[model samples]
Target: MTGSPLLALPGAVVGEGLDAGVAAHYGNPMVEQRRLEQGRAFVDLSHRGVLTVTGPDRLTWLNSMASQALDRLAPGEGAEALFLDASGHVEHAVHFVDDGGRTWLVVERDEAAPLAAWLDRMRFMLRVEVADVTAEVAVVGVMADPSALPAPHAADAIVWHDPWSAASPRGYQYARDPQHPASAWNWTELVVPRAWLSELADAVRSGRAEVAGVLALEALRIAAWRPRFATEVDDKTLPHELDWLRSAVDLHKGCYRGQETVAKVMNLGRPPRRLVMLHLDGSDTVLPVAGDPVVGEKVRPEPAPGEATERRVVGRITSAAMHHELGPIALAVVKRAVPATIELIVESHGIDVAAAQVEIVPADAGAAVEVPRLPRLGVRP
Candidate 1:
C-alpha cells in the first residue's frame, strides 16, 4: 500500500491500501485540528487532471465549446466552465486559464482523457492544440491569503489562482475546477507548479499553514453546500437541476454544443428537481451513504432504536459527513415542490437513519449577481 513513492509522507500512514482506490485517509489529530481552527488547509489534489490548449485559436475554440465566455479572458485570468451534451447536461466541468497564447483546462482525473478526446474531436477547422498534461502538471489545494504566495507564472510560472474568499485581493483570482464543480460561493482553487510541492507541503506541515484530511475536507465542503462529480452529478443528472447553470453555463456566450437545452431550461424556469441540504437527527448512530433513498411520504422503518418515523420519498442523499463544528450534515436531491422542513429517513449501509429536517437554501442565495447563466432549454412540468 505504501509502496508508491508518492504515498511516502512523513508521519503519514496509508489505510485501505493503494489497491482500495483511495490513496490515503488521514486520521491524524494534528491534521484534523488544523482544518477546524485555522479555516485554511492544504491537501494532495494530485488525483486531479490537467490539460493544455495551445495555438492562436485556443481562446476562440474553447469559448465556442464551453459554457463560459472564454473569448474575453486575458492572460493570467481563469474562468469556471462546463461542457454540456444535447440535453444541456454537464459532460465535464473545468477550470480554464488563458496564458496569452495557451489555455489550460484543469479537471478531475477520471474525466481528463475523455474531455481531451472530446476537445480534440471538436477541433474541426480550428487551429488549436489540445493535450493531456496530467503527468507533467500537479494540482494542489491552498486556502489562505494570496499575498503569501508570489504572483503565479512569475519567474517560477504560477499559472493558476482560484481563491475562495468573498473579497479576495485584486491581484488574486479564483476559478471553478470542472472536476468538482459547485455552485457554492465559498469554494476556491489554485494551480501551483509540481516543483513547489515540497516547499508547500513543508510549509503546511510546519504549522505556518494547515493540512486537511479527506474527512474534514469533505465536512467543510458539505457545510459550504459544494457539489462534487461523483456525489452530486452523473450522466442522467441535468446541470440545471444541480444548480450548475449559474456558474458553469453562460447564457450570453456564443453558440456551443447543447446550448439549445440550456436555453430551454432557463426560459421554462423548471427543472425536474432541485438539490438541497438535509439536517439529520438520528445520524448519530447510523449515517446515510450516498445514493440512499430519501423518503417523501409515509414513515420508513428505522434501522436502529430511537430513530424517527413518518418519512416519505422526497430525494436521495448525495453526500454526508460529520463536522467538528456543524455535527452531522448532508446534501440531498429532492423534488422541487418537496417541503424543505419535511423529516425523512435515509437508508445507507443497511442502516435506516432519521433525517431530522431538510433545509432548502435558495440556489443563488449569496452567490454573485454577475455569475453566468444558462438559457432555459425547455419546461419540465
Candidate 2:
C-alpha cells in the first residue's frame, strides 16, 4: 500500500515495516504524546485495515467464530474479540462496532486480508456479507470520548471505544493488581470514508485539532500495558498469557474455534507463560526491539561434580517504547516459572539492558476451579 495522504503534512517521517507508509513521528514525539494523552490531539491510523460485515446473520456468525460474546452486542457498543486457531493460539485480534446496519471491524493491516478470507470461507449458509473495505474506509484514533470529535463518517458513523480498561462481563482478570494500569486508558477509533483523509489533515494544519504519529500513540499504549495483536501475539500465544481474558474472552460463552483450550486452561490448567512490564535501565542509550532475548540466571544440574547456574533466555520482548512519563519500558512474555521479582537482561544491539519485572499475569493464572487432589501413589490410607 502507498503512504497515507497525511504523510504529505510537514514534519512527517514515514515508518518502516509493519508501520510502513504511516508517519512514525512529526518532528517532536514527546510533545505529541503529551498532547495526545490529554485528548488534545488525534492520530492518523488510515493505514489500518477496515472490514464490514452486513446482513441479518452478521452478529450470530461472528459470535460463533470469535472469543467474545458478540451475538447480543448492541449497536454503537464497542467490543474486542479474538480469532483463534483450533489449538487456541490467537490468529487475529479484532476491534469492532455495529451501527445498526453494518459491523465495522478494525484490524492490523497485515491480518486484514487473511482474516477476511477466513471469515468469507466460513459463510456457508449464513446471511452475512463480508467485504474488505480497506481502500474505501479509514480509521482515526483519539484518546477521548467520541461525542466531541467531528471525525468524518460515511453513512454509518461508528466510533469504537476500546474496552481494555475494564474487565468484560463473563470474563476473568488474570492480573492480581486491584488497580490495573489500563484503568486510566481511554482509547477510541473512528471509522470514516477514505476520501476524508484530506479533511482531517486540514483540521490538523489549521490547528482546529492537533496531530500525533504512531510513535506517540505507541508510547501511551505501552504505559497502559495494553496488548496489541501485532506486537504481543506469537504462534504459541494464548489470550491468558497476556491477561487478555479480562477483555477479549468470555469464560462461559458458547463454543467457538478455540473454546476447548480456553475452557481447559481456565478450569483445570495454567497458561505456560505470563506477561510482564519491564522497567528498563535507561543508562544505556539503546532501547530493545521486539524479539530481543530476555535472559536471567537459573539453577541447573551441574555437568561436573558441583552445581552450576547460567544465564538463559527465558522470554523475548514483545514491544518496547520510551514513555513520556515512565522512562524506557517494555512488555515481555516470559516463561511461567520466571520469578516475578527477578531483574532480567534484554539483549539488544550487542548490549544487555537491565530490566526490572512487574508482573502483569501472575504465575498462578488459570485453573479457576478448585479440584480436590487424590492420594499420591499408595501413600494415603
Candidate 3:
C-alpha cells in the first residue's frame, strides 16, 4: 500500500487486505462509536478529489462544465454534479459547494487532476482558475444535524454533506440537516485545521460512536440501493441507467458534453438494462457474487414451482452484500424487458445459486417528474 500522510494519523487504521486501487480507513473506535450513536461520523476522504475554483468566472465556468447548475449555489450550499462523456456516461461524480467567495469541487480522487485539466482546456475565454487541491485539503465525512453547524464551517473542513434522512453510502459524505431531513440535501464544505483533527478524533472517541468499516458501510449502501462510483457505475453505464438522473444529471440545465445523448435517451425510451435490487433465495447453499450471470428468458419460461431448468441468461450482478437486516441483498443491472419478479441464478466461485423474488423497477419510471433544473451559467440554448 502506498503511504499517505493522511492515513498516518494516530488511531486511524487502514482497511486490511485491500489492493492499491482502493483506499479506506477505520478511525479510532471512540470516534466511530460517537458517529454511529449520533449518526454523525467523520473519516479521512483524502482519496477523493479536492478542487479549488478561484477567479471571477469560477461559478460561470463550473456551471457550464457540470450537469448541475452551479451559478446559483449560494455560499454554504452544495449540489451534486456529474462530468459526463459525449455519450452522457458519467466520467466522474462531483460535489460542488460555495465557500465564501471561492468554489470548491469534490470529485473522485483519481479523476481530480483529469477533470481539472478538462476544465482548464474549456476555460477558452473564462476568467476562472482551476487547481487540484487534493493534497492540500483534508476531506472528512460527517453525518449529523446540519442545523447545528453553519455552511461556511461545513465547507471548509467538511468537504461534503449529503444531509439525507437515510444514511448515504460509504463513498458518499452526507449529513441529515433539519431543514431537509428526508430529501437528498447537500452541505457546504468545512475546513478543519490539520492540527485539530487529532483533537476532533479524541472528542469523537470519547463519545459513544463506533467506527464503521467498509463492510458495514457497504451493508448500509446496499440497503439504500445507492450506486457507487467504480462498482455500480463505469464506462458502460449511462447516467439514466444507474438511476442517477435524480441527483447527477440536470435535464433542464443547458447543453453539456453529453446532453444530446441524455436528452435522446430520455425522450426516446428506456435503456437496455436498468438497475434493480435482488432478493437472493435463502435455501441456496452458495450465494451469488457480483458479475454472475442473471438468467434471462431464453433458457425457459419463468420458474414453475421447483423447476431449476426454467432459467435463461439476461444480465449480470453488479454488487452484492449480505445484509444484517435484509439477509443477502444484491443489486444487479438486468435486461429492461425482464419481468418484475423472476427467479434468477448467480454463479459465485463456480457454484450456481438461485436468486428468488427480484424486485425490479424501471430505471426512469419514478424519476421522470419535472424538477428545478440547476440554473445555467450564461444564456439558455
The 10-residue segment with the lowest total lDDT in model 3: 168-177
Q: Model 3: how far is 189 from its true place, Å?
A: 7.4
Q: Is candidate 1 or candidate 3 better by TM-score?
A: 1
Instruction: Give the CA lDDT, 0 to 100, for residue 306 in model 3.
Output: 69
Q: What's the CA error at residue 46 for candidate 3, in Å?
A: 2.9
Candidate 2 clashing pairs, residues 3+ apart or interchain: none
Candidate 3 residue lDDT tens string, 1-381: 134443444454565432122234363333343343344544444355677889888887788877777778777777777778887788888777787688877766667788888888988987878887665655555445432232333434544555233332321121112332234222223445444444444444555322333444544556656666756775778766666665566667877788787777666656667777777766665656667887744444566776665456777887776656577778888777777665666767676666763443453243233555787799677
Off by over 4 Å in 3: 1-13, 16-40, 146-159, 163-197, 204-210, 281-290, 297-312, 356-381
For residues 105-192, write the lDDT of model 2, one tens digit per residue. Answer: 9999998999999999999998999999999888888888653344433234568889988887789888888878898889989888
Question: What is the C-alpha RMSD, rounded to one decimal, of candidate 1?
Answer: 7.9
The prediction achieving the highest lDDT against the true structure is 2
What are the lDDT scores of the predictions, listed in order? 0.62, 0.87, 0.60
* Model 2 regions more than 4 Å off: 147-156, 299-309, 376-381
Rank the models by TM-score, top first: 2, 1, 3
Error of 1 at 217 (Å): 2.2
